[model samples]
Target: MGEVEIRPPRPEEYAVAGEVTVLAYQADGHLADGVGYDATLRDVARRVEAAEVLVAVDRAGDVVGTVTIVQPGSEYAEISRPGELEFRMLAVAPSARGRGIGDALVGAVFDRARALGLRRVVLSSLDRMHSAHRLYERLGFARLAERDWRPFPHVMLIAYQIDV
Candidate 1:
């Protein structure tokens, strides 16, 4: 991998970008084989229409990571308030992990929030995603325990936030 470009994916790359997101989640054990949520994760087209979807493409233009930025009223936003931006479905290909791709993706989220003049950025993560929690903390996000909630049975999501 040479330089990575973080930007909205080209329309032709939607399927591949969606597949990369699903692969990353499955590889990380955050998503199970044959789960219905896989469909949601792979629906990049829907996300593109409802929010800002960004991809981290390698020098060869292959998408290795992706994330969705959701405004307050979007269907994907779990806990964003007025004057805040929320991001969801952050994923980086397993082969591309440990290369600062995740950091870059989250950084891009902050950039988006700032560019939009939002006062903060928020996100939710599963408890099992310890590594992701570390990344968020390293990026100055604080735990928002009060905002934690379970979106589904047997699955609890924790919240984190950072003021821009």
Candidate 2:
């Protein structure tokens, strides 16, 4: 219930961010299938090295959320095209949900996109993440159904875009 800071995770905070991401996903039943996605969620270091990894920290300086922003041609980018910025792996701590941390982190992404002179920002979310979809809609993102994709069998990823 205090001010939350959105910034890049420090070297020592990478592991903390990774743990928070994993915990958030597991708490939301996103990892219920015992799939290999848990490892991906916990690989904050890899994401940090490959893209910009942003973390939301509480007033006490505890990392409560994380998101990875990928540039147009970054290896982590999936559905983004030229002139668009893409973000992925957005996760907020279970205890910190509904505290505006996710919104703040996403706002940071939009800020970064504008700062880079990008025309749009794009992201993909699991179909079942209704709360996140609501947040994206509230932030002015519109679903791009034609761009929706399935990276794995039986797993559909929905795409959303917002012109910045």
Candidate 3:
């Protein structure tokens, strides 16, 4: 383990986005549904370069953790409330957990939000991700609500919001 690299991703790196997503949520039997096309990956890289996404890669260049912060107008932001930035995805690859990477990613979001003049942030997570709940709480993200919605049946989900 050398110096960990935290930086904007390149367009070619989007392929790893799909792989990482699949790996991160594999415990729940989640798989990619053909949604991560080339365009999506390119957009992800663009966002990464714009400070809209924070990705943590190991010294050898594998993406271990990733977080996306969306401004009020970004597509993934469904929260209609005012002055809110949606923390779209905060995923730390299973192999990289327990190393405080999640904590560092959230800290990066905090600094980013302050720099962008955003005061609030929110994200959705599955209820089964109990460890994630603990991590968010430890980082001062409080539970605002929980609901069941989207891609399948019996998928209980939670919404966490925080003022940064």
Candidate 4:
């Protein structure tokens, strides 16, 4: 209901951003308690240090969503290749859904890629994340079926890429 700003999280806001990420993932059934992936999603400080962590804040200056953008060769990079940028761990607060915060955060990644003269933006998502898949499609991301991977048994990660 108010203006939203997309920017890097301040040091003091890391904890809040991590909490928002955890809550958003849990509320969406994207995470389970006591899972190793849950801890990864809750580690905003680590991501901020290893990659670019962006947060969306409302007029009240509360973090409503967040995403982590990783460059090629970065420690957190999973799907990006040379000449491409990758992002992961996109989360929008449950209460903040449908407000375009997710789109704004993603757009920020595209902006960054363009500024860096990258050819494309890439990411990986779980198969069950249909909502996120739709958003990616709407933003011109194409399925990279050959690049789909499975990090753990029975857990497939679908890949997508968009030319920027």
Candidate 5:
């Protein structure tokens, strides 16, 4: 880990959303399942004004990871608890995977979550990604439930929640 700095996403950093989305979710042949990375990036852009986004920048100031913190609303109606914050999109570039960039991005969320006095943080992750599941567990997130989700062929939708 070479000085990973996690900070709030700025207006200019929005330009990296699409590229990051593609790297985070796309290029995985098994998980493609007809989902559109472009649409996800657009949603991220649209929610930027209301959502809390954290980006991981290396010592050189290049973004290597990102995590979006979404609050409850009609936008996040799936979340039953209004006081909960969702760790929606968490991603670390392939090259930065083992360097603690993901941990830094997630830590930024926890820092903000504590300041806001949030009750819990929730997230949905695909079950196929076992390593990611381990990472979330290592961060103290426990499995809440698993269900079938939309936009993909995967039937296992593991949801996790962590109390603040």
Candidate 6:
């Protein structure tokens, strides 16, 4: 693996980030329900209009991972309250799995939360994403089972939180 930088993506890289996010989720079988969530996953530009979009870029300057950091009242925030930050759409390219890019990207979220003077960060993930659950646990996120929700009939999103 090459050196990876976790930072806000350039405007020109939005499409690449969106595609990487969509493809990553697809490869992980998170898109099998045919609920049209891919449209949201592919809208990096839209997400950037409301929240911070961070990308993991390799030494070659290719975006291999992406995540959205949502402020408490932002359009992408679903389970966060005042003084709490939320993250959404975490995705690492299939080819870049196991290279720690996801960790770096999520670490950047913590950094952003601290920068914003927030102490708590929350996120929702697909229940079937066992590997992601492990990563969240390793990063100190505890399961927020009471906050689990279903945005659609075919999808149930489990919640997690960590205090930074």
Q: On lDDT, who's better, 1 or 6?
A: 6
Error of 1 at 28 (Å): 1.2
Q: Please give the CA lDDT of all the candidate structures.
A: 0.90, 0.91, 0.68, 0.90, 0.71, 0.92
What is the alpha-carbon lDDT of model 3 when measured against the actual structure?
Answer: 0.68
After superposition, which runs of candidate 3 have C-alpha atoms over 4 Å from their true positions? Answer: 1-3, 28-51, 146-154
Clashes of 2: 0
Pairs in steric clash, model 1? none
Residues 1-164, candidate 4: write the lDDT tens digits. 24699999999999999999889878878775334787888889999889999999999989999999999889998888999999999999999899889889999999999999998999999888899999999989999989899887768899999998
- Using lDDT as the measure, the top candidate is 6
**Which residue ranges in model 4 land beyond 4 Å of their true spot?**
none
Model 2 residue 52 distance off true place after TM-score fit, in angstroms: 0.3
| lDDT of residue 35 for candidate 6 | 87
> Residue 60: error of model 4 in Å?
0.5
TM-score for every candidate vs. truth? Answer: 0.95, 0.96, 0.77, 0.95, 0.84, 0.96
Better of 2 and 4 by TM-score: 2
Task: Give the backbone clash total of model 5.
Answer: 0
Worst 10 residues of 2 by lDDT: 26-35
Q: Count clashing residue pairs per candidate.
A: 0, 0, 0, 0, 0, 0
* Candidate 1 residue lDDT tens string, 1-164: 24688999998989999999889888878875334888988899999988999999998778999999999988888998899999999999988889899989998998999999999999999889898999999999999999999877778899999998
> lDDT per residue, candidate 5, 1-164, as tens digits?
35787877667777675467557665443236565545665355665766777778788878778877877773643453677778776877676678877777777777777888887887877767677788889999888875235445544567888888
